[model samples]
Target: MRIGLLTEGGYPYARGEARLWCDRLVRGLGQHEFRLYALSRDREQERAGWVDLPAQVTQVRTAPLWTAEVDGTWYGRRARRRFAQHYGDLAAGLCAGPAGAPGQGGYSPAEADRFRSALYGLAELAREEGGMVAALRSEEAVRALERVCRAPGAPRAAREARVTDLLLVGAHLEQALRPLSLDWYEEGELGSVDLCHAAAGGLAALPGLLARHFHGVPLVVTEYGVPLRAHYLGSADAPPAVRALLAAFHGRLAAEVYRSAAVLTPGNTHVRRWQERCGADRSKVRTVYPGMSAARFAGAGERPGGRAGAAGAGAEPGTLVWVGRIEPSKDLVTLLHAFAAVRQRVPGARLCVAGSAPDPEGAAYLLHCEELAGRLFPGDPPVEFVEMGGPAAPGLADVYARGAVIVLSSVVEGFPVSVVEAMFSGRATVSTDVGAVVEVVGGTGLVVPPRDPRALAEACVALLGDPERRDRLGAAARARAMELFTVEQNVAAFHRIYLEVAGRCPARRIAEADAAAPRPFAVPAELRVAGAGSVEVTR
Candidate 1:
């Protein structure tokens, strides 16, 4: 199968959110040919370079989202008029708030139709006009957006947008929607692919959206974290007008993507609920948990002494392990306070926090946690706040091996990856009930409400005090992780999905030919197939 893997801030990049998963997926499915369409988030990421791609990956095309140079493509007067009409409808649709327009929520049939028509109309215009760089950045585009914002019945916030707000929102829209102008839906690109698999929603799904629109390509979207939710959280501090417009635009886009895709796979039930709330069809959505490699932790999990309650297994007595990037969202404050309570119950208990700080904010948060730990446990604190894999801490598997109980205290989470790793290492876990924690834990371990130090401490003390329960839960967690969250299971599920989509929906390879595509396959009259798809008559 020829699969076009669409991504944003991920895969092929050495450092990215979804890079590891994409690399693993491609490597696992060596039978398929892959074409990568990536969007670089910044110059630093581009300079960081990409991971070594497998031989089956035939092409990689990338665009930047960090720069805003003039597109410089001039349009004819007639083309400008067409661009105005299409972009006008798109802008108006974006400005419509849930209260004003029926189609804005995309739940009602009429509203969904309104959203789809305006969206595809703009896509068609971009296709015929070569690119939208000039059109989207033109003064006329700003005027169009301004008119929508000021229009009667528009969102109240949008109607009050200042001139500066309009300009900023216009430029932001151009950057976010830039993928619509990319020349990817041609015979040699997405058109030839048997399936268009988007690695994320929103920006990552844009190319797949075009492919499915222009050609009859089937699309399958996999989202561990819904992009729409992220946008809402990230844009909270922006101007009210900008926030409203962007949110409405993204909401409509997500709904359309879900409706158009043949299948929607959310990493956990947590993500599935978010998508459903954003208007995704319940029948089309499936929950597929992210997969992890178990081999790296085999030494910790398979050791004879590693049996749950076994004395002298590598586990240090009364130690609690915490592993993940050190950030405020992890709520280390709550963890520290909870540990203080745990010490009262089990005086000899020790806490080990082992994870690197990925940014300055996280580094600052880590320092704050250290200070808080000191205040809680003064000199020779029972809490050992460590960063990176060094003498103070150690590698993740080593951290898990050193603890009888792994704890995740995050108030905000996606899939609780650290807990999964602990499970793979055959360790009992006490994690807060947030995001996918409950779904991932699946009755395998203890769960407590987030941000409750007393509750969290109590749960930890119970597991720590009972070695037999720890042993039982650890063994069960290890078994569950092996069965549901392993790479083998993930790959197998996607393999079946690909075959199902391809078997039912044939590739739209021929439609690109109607556009006078440059590929030899589009012009059989000028070339004769000599052998193995090679053209002998081409000049």
Candidate 2:
């Protein structure tokens, strides 16, 4: 089987979970060939270069989503008319109110069809012409957007859109729709792949949608975090009109992607619910947990009853561990206050905050946390901050081994990777009830409500005081992690899913003999299992 793996931002290039998981997926499924279709987030990511490719990776193609290049494809009179009509319909769809005032970002079937038709129509136009680069950013496009925004039945926020708002929305749409202009849909490229598995939804899945549109390829969309939810969370500061327009656009796009995909693989029930709310078919949705390696935590898991200080991993009997990226969303300040309460009860209790700051905002938040810790615990603060990879920073295994209990204080989280890691390391955990924290912990650890220092501190104190309970939870967590979240399980689930999707789709091969035909796969053949015999590449 040949797979066209689609991704955006962190993968192959950027050093993060995206890169790790994708690399693991390809390496684990060595029997299948992979073709990477990556969209880089910025120059920094592209400059970072790619990881070593395995022999099974037949090809790699990357494009930039951060910058737009003018392809100078001037449209003639007829082309200009086609562009205006399609662009008008698309903009109008964005401005239309949801059925029965279902509120912003809500799906209305009639308008969904309009948006879907206009999107593919624009894609078809881009294919006919060289690209939609200039036209998408043209004065005419802005005018079309403004015209739709002012139309009779447009949403109130959209109707209030100013000229500046139109330009901002238009510029964003141009970058997003740039995928439609890519030359990857040709017969010998994506058309030839047996399956197209998107590493994410939203922009990452756009190419796969085009492949399904142009050829008969099947698409599988996997989302660890729903992109629409991210957009809503991140766009809080944008102007009302701009926010409304973008939200509706993303919501409609997600709906169309869900409607078209052969399968939807969400990393947890949290993400699965988001997909369903946005119009995903429940029958087509599968929950596949992200895979992690237990080898690094093997020694830690084996010594669940061992004291961290005894092993020189840097923790006392009452030390609590917090591990993850340093950001405002992590709610570290609350963790500090919680620790203060824990210290009052346990007397010798301490907290160790260990993680890296991915951005400047996070760095500032880390400083605030440090100051808060100083104020709360005064001289010789028991709260320690350790940057990942620093000289004093503990190794991954040591990080868990050092703590009597692992703590997660995030007000917002998605598939809490650290919780799984802690579980693999055989450590009892205390995580806030956010995102997939409760789902991932699977009753193996204590969970508290977010923003409640009292609850968080109580949970930590309980675990610290009861060594037997901690050991039991730790052992159970390790068992659960091994059974459900290991690399072998993740890879096997996907392998089976791949075969199931392939079996359900029509069996055909894109024959080179009729390469010029509009429908590339004009030939048919019987579908065979991967090892049974030679199987033709058909989506």
Candidate 3:
């Protein structure tokens, strides 16, 4: 099978989300040919280069989302009229209302159709007239948005949009719609693929949506984190009117993608809920847990002394381990306070925070956490913040092995990867009930409410005091991780999904001649079977 794998700001980039899993998926399914369509987030990511490609990956096409230069596509009078109609409808979709609202969610069937029609209409125009980069950034585009905002029956937020708001929203729309102008929809390119598997939602799914529209290719969308939710969370500081428009735009786009996809694979039930809330059909949504390698931690998990056995000779029985990217969302301050309570309950309890500060904001947060820990514990603080992969914190399995109780104190999270890793390492965990923590934990470990130091501390103390309970929980967690979160299971699920989707939506035949076109079952089963002495096959 020929699969077009779509991603945004990820694999095969050296840095980004879903890179490792994507690499694993492609490598695992070497029987099928893959063509990669990746969108680079910025110049730095592009400069960082990509991971090594396997032989099965036939081609790779990438575009930068950071830059939108003038493409010099001069539209004539007829093209201008076409652009106006499509752009008007698109802007109107944005100015409608919030997504998933009671009645005015902005994604009624008529409204969603209008949004999708306008999007594909623009894509067709771009294909016919080269590109829409120049037109999307033109004064006419801003005027169209302004007109839509002021139109009768428009939402109050839309009506309240200033000229500056219109311009800002318009610029953002250009970036989001930039995928429409890509030259990847040619018959020999995206159109030739049997299946378009989008690695994420939002912009990453845009190309797959286009391919399914332009070519008869089937689309399968898998989302670990819903992009619409991320957009809403990230755009909180934007102007009210701008925020409203962006929300509606993304909402309508998500609804359309869900409606069009042959299958929707969400990483967890938490993500599935978000997709359903955005109008995804329950019948189409399937929760596929992210695949993780367990081989590295299997040896540690099988040790006799349980958690302490893997922690080496210097292992601390009461140590609490926290591993992840250090950010405000992690709420390390709450973890520090919780540790203070744990120390009161179980004296000499140590806390180890091992993760990297990805940005300046995270670095500042880390510093704040260190100071808070000092204030809580005073001199010779039992709390230690170690940079992941540094001298203090060597590797993931090693870090997991050092502590009896793995702790997750995040106020906001998606698919809690650290918890899964801890589970794989046969360590009991205490996590806050946020995102997919409950779903991932699945009664295998203890979970407390987010931002509650007392509850978190109590959970930790219970696990630390009862070695037998900790061992039982750790064994159960390892079993659950082995059953549900391994690479083999993940790869197998996708492989099955591929066949199911292909069976339902037949691949587009490449040529008029049967000899040139790829067939689903080209070779007869009887002929392919071993030890069948030249068996006659009937079609």
Candidate 4:
């Protein structure tokens, strides 16, 4: 099978979960040929360089999401009219509320069809016109949007949008809808592949949507994190008008993707709920958990001279370890407060925070955490920050191995890799009851509510004190991870799904194949009947 794997700031990148999972799939499923279609998030991501490709990877195609559309500065009168007609319907659709979203009822099936027609019409216009940038940025585009926002059927929120909001929306729509102008659906591109598998939703899934639209190709959208939700979360920084317009645009796009995709694979039940809320058909949605490399932590996971699985490979007796990228969402402040409580309970307790701040905000958060540690225990701070994936433990297993209890204090999370890594290391976990933590832990470890320092402290203290119980839970955790979350299991699940999806669409594909002149002996002797139908085969 040929798979067109679509991604954004993921797969084939030097870093990130999407890259890792894609690499694993390409490598593990050697029977299938993979063509990576990746979208670089920014200049830095493009400059970071791609990971080494596996033997099964046939080709890699990349486009820059951060780059401006290469617009040819001209549009004739007919072209202007075409753009207006298509853009008007698109603008009107964006002004309406998506089904199940808060607004004037929901976009009815008729409205949905109208939206789809408008979206595809614009896509066709973009292809015919060479690009969308010129028309999308035209003054008429803003006027069209303004008219739609104030229309009778427009959402109250959209109608409240000012001129600045209309301009912002028009600009954003130009960028986000740039996929409609791409030639990825042309011959020998994504259309040639047997399956179009989107590694994420939103922009990453756009190409897949187009491939399915143009070629009748089956699309499998795999979302480990809901990009629409991410957009909504980050939009809080924008003004109300800007936020409302972007929200409506993204919501409408998500519904279109969900409605058209052959299958939607949400990495966890946590993400699955988001997809469901975005109007994904429940029957077409599958919960396929993200796969992690258990081999990375196999050394620490080995049960040695123990009654049960202990964090035996250089495990410290009373230390709590938190491993991940240092970010505000991780709620390290709560972790610090919890550790302060742990210190009072266990006099000799210690903490080793192993992770890096991935961004400027996170770097600041890391420094703030250090300062908080100083204030919490000025005289002799037991909380030490160690650089994880160090030369001594390059695999990151040493970070998990060094702890009696693996702690996670994230208030916002999505199928946390740190918890799974700890489980693979046979280390008991104490994580906040957020996102997929409870689902991943599966009764193998303790889960406390987010922002509750006392609950976090109790969970961590329980694991640190009761070595026997920790050992049992650690064993159970490792077992569960192996059974459900290993790379092998993930690949196998997707492999089956790909076959299932493609199997259902074979007739359509076959119908599209060229029925050229038939060879004289095309029919076998045994199979050839004397009067099998009219017998006027194509010549």
- Give stretches of model 1 more than 4 Å off: 99-107, 304-312, 389-393, 507-539
Clashes of each: 2, 0, 0, 0
Instruction: Assess the local accuracy of residue 331 in candidate 2 as a C-alpha lDDT between 0 and 100.
Output: 98
Please report how far candidate 1 places residue 224 from its true position, in Å.
0.5
Q: All candidates: CA RMSD in angstroms?
A: 6.5, 4.2, 3.8, 6.1
User: Which of 3 and 4 is the better model by lDDT?
Assistant: 3
In the range 1-539, model 2's lDDT, one tens digit per residue, is 77899999867785533688888899998888788999988898888888998998889999999998899899999999999999999999998877742322365777887898899999999998979999999999999999999989888999898889999999999999999988999878898887899999999999999999998799998898889999999899999999999998998888888888999999999999888888788889989989889889877776545422122123358889999989999999899989999999999888889999979999999999998898998888898898897777679888788888999999999999999988888888999999998888988999999999999999998888888788788878888889999989989888878878877886555565545653322223224457656655443
Instruction: Using lDDT as the measure, name the better of candidate 1 and candidate 3.
Output: 3
lDDT of model number 2: 0.86
Write candidate 1's Cα lDDT for 482-518 as tens digits: 8999988888778777766665663344444346653
User: What would you estimate as the lDDT of candidate 3?
Assistant: 0.87
Which of the predicted structures, 1 or 2, would earn the higher lDDT when compared with the native? 2
lDDT of all predictions: 0.83, 0.86, 0.87, 0.82
Model 3 residue 331 distance off true place after TM-score fit, in angstroms = 0.6
Candidate 2: stretches off by over 4 Å: 100-105, 303-315, 390-392, 512-539
Candidate 4 global TM-score: 0.91
Which 10 consecutive residues of model 3 have the lowest summed lDDT?
Answer: 521-530
Tens digits of per-residue lDDT, candidate 4, 386-495, equal 76544654448767888898999998998889999999889899999988999999999999999999999998888888888888898888889889899989998897
| TM-score winner between candidates 2 and 3 | 3
